[model samples]
Target: MRRPLIGIALVAVMGIVVWQWPGSDAVASAGAPRAAIASQPVANHGNWLATPTADGKLTMVAGGQLVIDAELRRLFDFLLTDSAEKPIRQIKDNARKVLAERLAPGAANVAYTLFERYIAYRDALGNVKPAADATPARLADVVGRRNALRRQFFSEEEANGLFGEEERYDRFTLDRMAIEADVSKSAADKRAALEALENALPPALRQARREPVTHLVEADKAAELRAKGASDEDLFRWRSQEFGAAAASRLGELDREQAAWEARLDRFAAERNRIQADASLSAERKQQAILALQNSQFTTQEQLRLDAALALRARQ
Candidate 1:
């Protein structure tokens, strides 16, 4: 197929705390000592609930009723932070306390068991590595092992709640990678593979994957046109045909911004050349003049671009 060397980022399933921006109601209720935890209207998709807390934050509710507590939140934060520095046993002990306080008598035991299994899954992933010339089968084997581990640790329903769509994502990625690596396959075959892979995905993820692929293909086409010295009009027409009016309009805006930036750079270069050629000025004075000119002409972002351009010119 001679497919492009596209980097596909594999999805990792981990238990992490999600933070959402505070809503108006949450903000208004903040600082109230005993604010009621309101159930936010979430889609009836699974055993999950969006419960708003008194501190203008939202926490996950498991089994659609059991509100996850501050201890669990603290544990999640600790696990995520690179600087946590606590030993594994200590971390587990702390998480146990949090889960114990939050969950019902029997439910707490199950939650703690699940927590331990989650940590084991993470550790297993860290230790797994395939060979340098690993085949599609090898990749599939790794994915299958991970899934098996999940199944061993948690029930099907529980697994789905903790790692939504992750298993499907792994399968999709593995299939795509295999297709990309098959040199004997035709472009049409590869396209078919891509279509099948995308079709298998849930709607939301399918759209997310498709948009980036579309953008990459369009960018490559644009680069080819640029190399062939196509006119701006020609580029606009091409983009419009490929991606539609909205994308073409956005590209036009970007082109105008770029042209303005280049014009300013040209002006700066001319002024800098003039300063350099002024024999009356000392070297230190010339440097100071250039600095002053740069400060006057460019905003922070523009200054960064100007500095990069100057560095590239110096290198050449």
Candidate 2:
């Protein structure tokens, strides 16, 4: 079975930082050292250090240098790099050391706990195996399991710090997925489900979700119409209504190009037939003529498509 389209939802949840969490101070303290308000900018390497606020909040210095320690930078590099070949155990160990060195006395443990949960969450997500007949309930169950793990591992404050806006977005996605997977529901019911989900999201995220949903729905409708032998003009109108004038115009150009290509293919087919039927041409001459015709008709990229189309036609 194909993997469910839950990756986007997962990314949305994991990528965001919960700035409003009550325990934000604990996490923030792990960041760069606070600079004094009037501290002179020090040029370290290529970066400039900024003066801290009166309350000791880290601020950018005049130069490009960040106030963060070298160890913190190294830690970030290790985490961000493609470590697919490296052992997970080694990475975790390195991460612990980095956090211990960089974070404040009490903050390091909280940060480390978040890191551990994140890694475990990812591993569990990878292992989820949906049933052959994937239903709304089955898919929801998978999401539920993930949520359960999250709840089990992190407190409300920790979740807020780690997930932030992503938490709501993920719930929104699961609700949307459940609606889509419910084959028992009518089209109207699915539409209602989706609308309700959108309405429930935060204003910014509501708009974000709406655009993709609209694009996908319209694109699917266009494909359906095309399969039913809709004209290019009809498709242009549909696309315009769905995606606005700019996208519609772009698609119209693609349609005209495709029509021109098909016409060229027809001409090539006629010429090839004439060459094949020529009684005066020797077998070697006929082969040479066909090769010459192919070279004249298509460039390398076009030739691949031309070959595939011809092969498909032959099969038909």
Compare the candidates by TM-score and give the number of the best one. 1
Candidate 1 on 1-316: residue-level lDDT in tens? 1111232222212211111111100112222222111111111111111122222112335653433332332244344344247787887787678666655656667666666776666556544443223355655665566567667766777665554344555566667778877999999999998888778767755544454256567768888998999888999999888767766877767678877877888899999999999999999999999999999999877787777887776798
For residues 31-102, write the lDDT of model 2, one tens digit per residue. 322211110111111101111211112222344232332222223334534457778788778777866665
Clashing pairs in 1: none
How many Å off is the CA of 275 in candidate 2? Answer: 2.3
* Predicted model with the maximum lDDT: 1
Report the lDDT of model 2 for residue 122. Answer: 52
For every candidate, C-alpha RMSD to the true structure in Å: 13.7, 15.5
Q: Please give the TM-score that candidate 2 achieves against the real structure.
A: 0.42
In candidate 2, which residue ranges exceed 4 Å CA deviation?
Answer: 1-125, 144-195, 201-245, 281-288, 311-316
